[model samples]
Target: MITPLIHYIQEHATFPLSETDISLLEEAFIPKKLRKRQFLLQEGEVCKYIAFIVKGATRQYTVDEKGYEHVLNLCIENWWTSDRESFHKETPSIYNIDAWEETELLLLPKANGYYERVNIIPAFNEMRIKLDDNQHMAVQKRLNMAQNYTADYRYEELTKLYPEFLQRFPQHIIASYLGITKETLSRIRHQHLKKAS
Candidate 1:
């Protein structure tokens, strides 16, 4: 379970990790498994841990007054999931995070000195910085798309960037993630298929 995370750190880290660094990481991250549809974080709860997905999928979403879920993020293998604001500020989250499939995660909790302990590793520290930068960029890109792009264009961009999502998640979930109605997504898919044909 930790192997994937170790590989992820190695791939993203600016420097190589020493044996002691690996031992520190092993001590910091706790492995957990979630059944499909199990909640990782629920609305109104403070997020306690930042989860790194080793296998399977998860979604972070919010429910409206009418009880319709709007997906804010979809995460799969090698992706990190957390309500960062809730985790950092110790405030309640408006979002709910759940497993879309039986998921394996390495959770880094705030309770212990885990963060400070891991930060001693130069490679882990650099990886954390890189993750923050990439997350910021992704958020900005998603916001720009939501504000300026058409539903068709958003769907196209999803296909280009995360084509696996089309296969892994349901149409309704994909539509919610794209901020479009399922009907509209269906129509767009039909049109794209026609063009491809």
Candidate 2:
């Protein structure tokens, strides 16, 4: 469906799409719905489609040898999610992505023919939008920030970047992303609140 995806493109695309471009997108993208906790991707599966969220949320995570889940990212409406390495390399994914709520998504298949056809449409150049490189850079930037800044600084930066994240995600997951223990995060949050009050 060209519904939410089109709106997302209009909001975020660097270039404008024409009627023919929309038609091409409609033909290429497949729509799907998932119930809460349903997995869009599982560890060890090849990710064939990059999904754009239309509604609800999803989390990408990995379980360690000790079985502790480490959150890599959370995707809400208008966000894109996929294991880029798996998708591009046609290899197994090490991460899992599951719906945090009942979700709607538009899936873009990763095939040369599909890409070629879509690239023929305006504002659809893969070269201009390198998803994998962007994703890697984002993760790297977050890691660098975590290493160099105090927890308070990192938390504030995250809040500025994703305003709804604190309200939407659990504290433990947020703590994990900040590379802190839950108790440490609690102390930081409490201290911040005390100062605000």
Best by TM-score: 1
- Candidate 2 lDDT by residue in tens digits, 122-175: 566643376557777998998899789988888888878987888878899888
Error of 1 at 131 (Å): 1.2
lDDT of 1 by residue, 1-197 (tens): 67888899999977998888888788889999999999999999999999999999999999999999999999999999999999999999999999999999999998888877887788888999999999999999999999999999999999999999999899999999999999999999999999999
What is the lDDT, from 0 to 100, of the residue 61 in candidate 1?
100
C-alpha TM-scores of all predictions = 0.98, 0.89
Measured with C-alpha atoms, the lDDT of residue 71 in candidate 1 is 100
Q: How far out, in Å, is residue 26 in model 1?
A: 0.9
